[model samples]
Target: MPDTRYTFLDTPIGALLLAGADERLRCIGFPTGKGAVTPRADWHRDDAAFAEARRQLSAYFEGRLTRFDLDLDPRGTPFQRAVWEELTCIPPGETISYGALARRIGRPSASRAVGAANGANPLPIVVPCHRVIGAAGSLTGFAGGLDTKKWLLALERGATSRVSEQLSLL
Candidate 1:
């Protein structure tokens, strides 16, 4: 608990709670549901600490940025961390089943475990947890709730399409 600082950033999804220390992002909380977060009793609020994050997130929502580049320090088990890292490999607008993700990590029989890790992701959109779907292609549970997940998927899909359309007209 190295003097962790926190801030709230507003985006299309909703107001987000960001917490971290020493310039590395630790957690990003959604506006509602179990993921909603409020500053802890000892947490300090500093807008300047998260300026770059705010800018990047805003750009993302506005479709100006496609991916996030930031220092992240999400706390989780080694297996969970591996899942989160693999999540980033899922290109925006594309999705895969938990079973597929499990195999990607060389754990073909660990779909359930992969789903669990996805649900427990400390970082959502940045890590792209919303891209993991049910085996039958149905959108699954997300910490930020299904609606937010749908919105993010739509945003990514739309952004990707626009990019492709731009390149094709050249």
Candidate 2:
């Protein structure tokens, strides 16, 4: 494997671990739980390597950025990659159920599998897996915990409302 650089970023939820190589972001781990990815021995700390990601994330939190434009190279199974790719298409402040996501990927009966893949997503906020919810619109399982998921959804909603208000003035 190539040399990967990592950095810890403090966010409203908690500190996040960002890892990447060759300018392609590979992972964004939470501080703990299933979402956490331990830094490898070969990994080196380099804030500069993740400056763009950090900047974009900050903008997102501040409601100044709606979409992320960065090179991503998350590692996962083909099905998981498909799920993650579909996740990126979910607009900010919008959400879909696991069943919906499964159908979107041409697997109408793979809702469980899709949820599993979502739980194992290597990148969370960037991939937007948190946007997936239960069929009844309940906040479901999130690698970063349900509270964090609620916070993210609320943040996006607030940002969307703010953007709408700004646009209405024009």
Candidate 3:
């Protein structure tokens, strides 16, 4: 594999690690936890490579941007990739159960599998894996922890309301 450029950015949640290659974002890792992506010896620290990601992420945190328009190249199995793709389709401020995600991918019996894929997602916020919840509307497991998930959901909800309010004014 080619060398991946990476950098760290501080956010409301904490520090986030951004990695990419050839101008396409490859991963958005948490600072520490099961989902954390540790620094690799081959990885190069390049803030310029992650400038756009940092900008968009900042906008997202500030509730000024909802959709991310960037090149993504997360490496995973075909099934995992499919799960991640569907995850991106989940609008901000909305939540979907693992079973619902499984059904959406045409594998109704693979809720557990879908959960696993969601857990293993290399790109978290951009992929929006935090939007997944339990069937009963409970906040489920997240790579960045449930607290972080709740914050993300709250951020999106607040952003949605702000956008709606702005639209109402116009």
Candidate 4:
């Protein structure tokens, strides 16, 4: 059967559709345009777990929290899990190139494969996938689009003030 626990969050970046299984958060995505996605009406709280997730997420959005402290159950292959695990180790304000991440995971020759896994990350911001960049020190593809990706990276480094000026909508 499908997971049942879910919630809709109004975040600084957009509306997030949060789904989970008991205490483990499964996915966090912006379904509609920024701040437009809403949780399913059938979304019923999982009591203890849901409350904790909401609390952590609230802290994150307000920029009070740098790292999350909740269980995550993102669905993916073993390689993807390795990639995500490596991503979590990336310091909050720092970033790593796909090649660097692959080398850290003991697969230096698999940079392209690592890039693929990063792109396939089931969870975006929560997993900190935005911290990964191209080998040439350039930004790359993001499921949420390049603008959102740049916003996230800038937010992490406290460098978003400039983007806010360039993009009035931010």
Q: What is the C-alpha lDDT of each candidate?
A: 0.86, 0.88, 0.88, 0.77
Off by over 4 Å in 1: 159-170
Residue 163, candidate 4: C-alpha displacement in angstroms: 1.9
Residue pair clashes in candidate 1: none
Tens digits of lDDT, candidate 4, 43-82: 6654444667778778866667889888888889999999
In candidate 3, what are the lDDT values of residues 1-170, reduced to their tens digit? 76899989898767999998977899898887777887799889987887788999999988899899888899999999999999999999999999999999999999999999998899999999999999999999998977678778878888435444544575
Candidate 1 residue-wise lDDT at 141: 90
Q: Each candidate: how many clashes?
A: 0, 0, 0, 2
Models sorted by TM-score, best on top: 1, 3, 2, 4
**Candidate 1, 75: how far from true, in Å?**
0.7
Q: Candidate 3 regions off by >4 Å?
A: 159-170
lDDT of 2 by residue, 1-170 (tens): 77999998888767999999987999998997667778999899987888889999989988788789999998899999999999999999899999999999999999999999999898899999999999999999998877678778878888435444544575
RMSDs, each prediction? 5.8, 5.9, 5.9, 3.2
RMSD score of candidate 1 (Å) = 5.8
